[model samples]
Target: MQLTKGVEQAICIIVLLSTQDNHNPLASDTISEHLQVSPSYLKKIMRKLVVQNIIRSVPGNNGGFSLAKSPEQITLLEVVESMEGEISIYPDTGLINKVFRDGVHTSKGEAVLHDVFNGANSLLRDYLAKQTAADLLKRTMEQSEIPVLNWNITNPSNQNKKE
Candidate 1:
């Protein structure tokens, strides 16, 4: 139920990069400054993102970090997995077996619990996957005082809504 701060920062970073001029890279310091995090700390989070290919590092004077793929291509779950790894809700399979003295009834109860937890986890995964980074980008643009031209032009789903 809880998301790591690193995951939050990573998503924020992605949103910032998406709004940048021409999707050009932004250095870590600039990103950190925007997010109000220390450059050094952001650097570590950025490293994981880059390694996972959520974002790419550019090599040049102006290079910093940029999304490896378009916002439409990146998912919140992917970003989270990159930063924090896979999450397990009710990961302990043997807990029910150890705790309950009644055998089959306890086993049935455990099965039900597993089904509920697993179902919830799958739903969560689906929700995150459907929430692309591009979605966040659009939301961010909407909230920003600066106006963006042709913002929804590239997103087909948004385009449909506009028409």
Candidate 2:
């Protein structure tokens, strides 16, 4: 399963917001500069995030964007879903049907394959939902060695635990 660049960028944007020192919103232009993403594209992604209440936009001269809640409250799955709609690891039904019709596998075989795919997808989503943005931020802060200016606390360990 491949994660789109839009989804990747959305995650990055959320992480960046989580790391900010000030409660004041961050302008799209500033975010664009920091992440080296196009302002127009970032704005489109930001709009989706705002609509989902994952982030909120403040209006006015000093306004920008800020998280609606703490990073711990946001899950990676939520950020990904906000930008990508849904997580679909398996190919669409049309493709699957075509493959089966093309005699790539017997009907029984196809049924087994579908069951396996569904099980795998469910497992992946459950795993993803367990990891929150706060967990990601913690790992980032620990590995970078650069002092976290936004939050005073440090992660328990600098090394990431393997799956």
Candidate 3:
């Protein structure tokens, strides 16, 4: 069960927001550059996040984006859902149909396999849903020995001038 690019980008955006100074909002262009993604694509993802209330946009001259709530309140599952709907690792239709149709297994064997796969899927979703963005952030901070650099300006010209 692999996560899509949209889902990965959403998580990265959330982590970036969590590391912000809190006083200043993050510009989408800046996030795009940092993540090495296209501005248009990132903007679309950002719109979904805004709609989900996962992040809020500030308009006009000092316009940018910020998390709608604290990191503790957000979950990775929520971020994923905001971008990709829901986390469906397994297809809804029973695997039994495939196995039985293919003659790979008997009907009875297929039924048992279906039950096992369904249970695993349920457990996976429950575990993922239970984890909050705050939990991930905490783990990251604890594990990292190196300090992260802060970029206050969005434009490279401004970033260069600062240096």
**TM-score, one value per model:** 0.76, 0.77, 0.73
Assess each prediction's global lDDT (C-alpha) against the native.
0.75, 0.75, 0.75
**Candidate 1 lDDT, tens digit per residue, 1-163?**
6778999898888876665543457788777776889999999999998898888899898778877877778998898888878755676658778778779878897888989998888888888889987777667656423222223233422422221
**Model 1 per-residue lDDT at 100:** 81
Model 1: how far is 73 from its true place, Å?
0.9
Winning candidate number (TM-score): 2
Order the numbered candidates by TM-score, best leading.
Answer: 2, 1, 3
lDDT for model 3, please.
Answer: 0.75
Q: Which stretches of candidate 1 lie over 4 Å from their true place?
A: 91-94, 143-163
Instruction: Output candidate 2 Cα RMSD.
Output: 7.1
- What TM-score does prediction 1 earn? 0.76
Which ten residues in a row are the worst by lDDT in model 3? 154-163
How displaced is residue 75 in candidate 3, in Å? 1.0
